[model samples]
Target: MPLTARHPARGLLDATQDDLGCGWAWDQVHNVTPRADLSCTYCQHRMHAKRSVAGLRYFAHDPGGPQCSLGLETMEHRLLKLQLATAIRGAGHQADLEVRGPEGRWRADVLATTGSGRRMAWEAQMSSITADDARRRTATLAADCVVVCWVFVEGHRPWMPYVPAIRVRPPADRADPWRVITGLFRWTGLHWEPVQVLLDDFVAWTLNEQVVPRRFSPPRDYWVGGWTAPQYLAQAARRRL
Candidate 1:
């Protein structure tokens, strides 16, 4: 399931808009006109509008559509990506879904862009991945000068401290907000400590430069650990600069 679909003429249709319609209405797209010609942005498979029991809106591949990697995406992954896009847009940035690098070098679940032209990729990595694999992916983005933030909404986050990432406690209800459990920290005069914050605020502050990534290199002073590299450096001197 994906929240975005490519319209032959309209270009891209965002299913998350709560309004009854986008440039096209929900009634026109959802089960009414199967000929609307909406297709998956990732796989080009035909897609149709779908709503969850809780009223979350997104697109699902039409029946008989070929198997696409995006079709394997879970509801958890879809929701997290949706939330990331919403937060990015709420902060006045452009949030392009399923954005890919040239020649498939990399892909971002939600690619955010600042008015100043800075770019960051927000990835909702719900599946289990080895730390080495995570580092390799992060390094790929780094080589392209593309900043990436890996967000884990479930499972053990063994790679959180190793990369510029964060672990969020999923809300019990879909309408509830996600809470940051780890990977965001503020420095005291002497050491680092976890910072409790909502996911929306974190994204907003980060895009606005209220927070930045910091590596506790030697990390011994913080007693955090080796292999524990990039983490958040929350508001203060950096914001002043």
Candidate 2:
């Protein structure tokens, strides 16, 4: 199942042994020696820990468990959802993880309300999702008076007919890289920082304009163009340098 926690108090990404989110340090858990809280996050069914012969440990539901579709969530998918939810809450917004939409037809990974009282649903897509499914979920949330935002994790690129998407990357040992002069960070240190780019600006610079095409062409094409909001911000930063 997507990385789930027995108790998601703080965002699941930062969950300790007591919560048991994902590939955590087993040693830490052993040291605590606390009673296990094995409950399925999706269906609330009784779960048990499965430690493979190869030393891989994970949570699994017992026999005759409820068929929760979200049980197919990967560890990466869970982490991304938790990380985005934490970021949203840290920014002074009220956020809830795994919130069900109106009539329970759909669920949002991170449902947040800004200080201005604007409600938005942030979905972290680490696994494959069909275009039709995406639109249906977005529409469901929209009908409930909530805006939908999609966050594509690393290795999962957004396809055509984009609906507000922000790509987030996992951390690496190498130097941090920016996305085409944009402040949007693939990963810095160990945190995933995603910058907000106006959809219109992104479409103009990334699709509509021939000046900034699919790939960076010629000498420093990205450095010259200020069509996108990120480009404008980068240009302004350069002047200060």
Candidate 3:
């Protein structure tokens, strides 16, 4: 599957000869030794005449080729955890990474203990809450012990709010709806707000929020919960680069 024809829901880039009807032709086109810059002469001539290349090379080559990057398999929530941990550590706080909890497991991306020795659990959320997980974590973690934060990234402005639990809608249709949802809650000031978000949007939200804050204060307790493995890996890779 070429990038242009790929399904929105699936990241697969089909390069099979059978599907492309070019058998070994594709290999020749893609595998040829590197050239400084390949340009279609015919298309260039037509462009000089101000014409379109709609059907000229439709079968000759795929304009949108395969995406060779093997992206990470982590979710935005997990990336947020990493970011929060990074931020907390930068803030000069005594932080721990990935702590266990009774309900399931609490991996504090960044754990911090206040000067007074008070514990604070911070989570970066970019997805909606399922009724069950929300109830369990809320019950297991003390309100005062936990301080849930969310980073919503959208057009122009982005917001980071420290709150309790974040309300996320079902994952459907949207790619990354977290930014939109978080934008909606900017004025509320409450940590937990019901919002619709997609996976990628949430990742962006977390990254923007964590990078800035972590530079100042590393978190005491950190957890992430809304993206897939690939997403998380990409984020981690970007940070490393």
Highest-scoring model, TM-score: 1
Per-residue CA lDDT of model 3 for 1-241, tens digit only, reads 0011222232222222223222323333343455112222112111101111321111122244333211111244444444444455445454443444545344332345655564555544344545455445543566446543333223221122222333334334434332224322211232223345543444334333431212112354323323223333345445555
**Segments of candidate 2 deviating more than 4 angstroms:** 2-38, 48-64, 155-160, 173-241
Give lDDT: candidate 1, residue 158: 73
Per-candidate count of clashing residue pairs (backbone under 3 Å): 0, 0, 37
Better of 1 and 3 by TM-score: 1
Write down the lDDT that model 1 would get: 0.76
TM-score-better candidate, 1 vs 2? 1
Q: What lDDT tens digits, residue by residue, belong to model 2 across residues 1-241?
A: 5334454432242231333435555444332546355566568776555544534444556678778766666666765665565556545566666776656777887777876676777676666777666767766787888866566654544341434455555445224321322223222334334444533333223322222212123553222112224444444445546
TM-score per prediction, in order, is 0.84, 0.54, 0.31
Off by over 4 Å in 1: 18-22, 218-241
Arrange candidates by TM-score, highest first: which order?
Answer: 1, 2, 3
Residue-level lDDT tens digits of model 1 in 8-74: 7778887766442246777777777346788987789888788888777888898898888777889
Off by over 4 Å in 3: 1-78, 102-109, 125-129, 150-241
What is residue 93's positional error in candidate 2, in angstroms?
1.4
Task: For residue 79, give model 1's deviation from the true position in Å.
Answer: 1.5
TM-score of 3: 0.31
Q: How are the candidates ranked when ordered by lDDT, highest leading?
A: 1, 2, 3
- Model with the higher lDDT, candidate 1 or 3: 1
lDDT of 2 at 135: 64
